[model samples]
Target: MIESHNTKGLIFNVQYYSIHDGPGIRTTVFMKGCPLKCLWCQNPESQRLQREIFFELEKCTGCGICVQACSEGAIELFEGRSRTNRKKCSGTGRCAEVCPVEARKIMGRSVTAKEVFEEVARDALFYQRSGGGVTLSGGEPLAQPRFAVSVLKLCKDAGIHTTVDTCGYASWDTVQQVLSYADLVLYDFKHIDPAEHKRYTGVSNELILDNARKIYHELAIPMLARVPIIPTYNDSADNIKATTQFISSELGKNIKVHLLPYHRLGETKYERLEKMDLAVLIEPPAEEQMLALQEIVQSFGLEAVLGG
Candidate 1:
């Protein structure tokens, strides 16, 4: 793919000085949009392509300020409780703009590549000092391939290291476009079996597995396959062994894998986003369980990391 000089991406967050995402202290750019609907997704807010409203019940004063501010009458106060009619709401952010307590927040915004690069450049000194740069994360950065590549190009021009944290579900062409600018890739490996993968993530694993191989072999991109260990979903010894075998034998190596233990940090977001029905909240595995899984990877003669 050719470089797009002025592509715009829908971004939700620009987190600075992060040590976990890449090689060193780095900034993580959270872009919006993803193909898979993983049951245990941590960033529920980043799943959609368009901007979304987050309603916090505790912060709401029930003053009806947002109700009046909403031109579409999407917000209403009932029994001193504020509710949003998601169907009526157009995500214009007008209600959020008028909310007194920030109870209503619009999550995503359209940002030009140049603008995003400027924000990342503010941390250039830290990147140089810590051998860290910028990490493109998301709902799957490859979902917005053009915008992703554009920002990556800016990072390349600035001599900053780039890492792409992806689900590896996009087309091979799209992967090639963005991989051109990425120095390291963080690939999410949810399940080895296609049936189990589709059961939890709502998509076939064929595309994802195929893309992983293309990244490692065909494209020759260095990538770390990370797994989110969900209890009863993918934490079994058999699952772990299967994943390690695939990473070690099929996927090109360094044979490095990161085990991301599931946590309930984003559980409340389900209610805020009114998506509890879609969420599969479960207790995280014990530290010992994680350690055991790590050892399983090591048993395969592959380097295993506890966290990403």
Candidate 2:
């Protein structure tokens, strides 16, 4: 069992009043680090396990405040723009703290489970009123098994409904440990074909599929499968049908399948993080396409809903 008192987790964001994650008016805690490198990933900053500096070139005025604040000499002004030497930057966030403009920002933070629990508990009234509670999301929450379990346990102990939004790629033991405290599981089923899955997400779907099957058969917890409909990726009719069929046969028809449409919301994030946006040219699935996929899921006797 994981201890909750002093366990610390690296979290990238804690989104409150989220209606799309799980149930009504929930808080989604975005943990740092992930095993898969999905091409259409929205949160690029969440991929790394440590704190990162996000520099917006347009917002930077080359004031040298960040340059002066950075004791490690990680920042330099070149042609009226502040550049960051990521390797030299210690992720101390001092440069961000001293920056006048909001150009410099830190991406992740380490917080105790107790601190997270307290913050989440603040919305207890809202959760109780709306049948919503707390959701542990990623950069696969299962990647930080102990911290995820700690936070979930604390929330569950306080009579708050807890949900784990995971990629379902972890070992069965890790999945079992975290799910023991989760009220619901928002599992991501990217692609049914293992090679295609690896081609797009940088990982095979074998372990993810196996873990999902085990979670359904071994655990009594309710699960909702989420699929991101990325263009030229896993948005094909064949992939959708195969995914829905697997969900219906292996995971049971009662499970709801959410077809999430891909968006370019994270395009700017890639620019800030200086990472390649592979899906930059890929457009979101059209409404008609989403509806068609939903129909396909319904054909397998499974409930399919567009968006979270």
Question: Per the 3 Å backbone cut-off, how many clashing residue pairs does candidate 1 have?
Answer: 0
Local error of candidate 1 at residue 63 (angstroms): 1.6
Tell me each candidate's TM-score.
0.97, 0.96
Alpha carbon lDDT of each predicted model: 0.89, 0.90
User: Candidate 1, overall lDDT?
Assistant: 0.89
Residue-by-residue lDDT tens digits, candidate 2, 157-221: 99999999999988888889889998999999999999999998999999999999999989978
Model 1, 10-86: lDDT tens digits are 99999987988989899999999999988888889999899889988888889998988889988888778798887
Worst 10 residues of 2 by lDDT: 273-282
lDDT of 2 at 78: 94
Which segments of model 2 are wrong by more than 4 Å? Answer: 276-279
Worst 10 residues of 1 by lDDT: 1-10
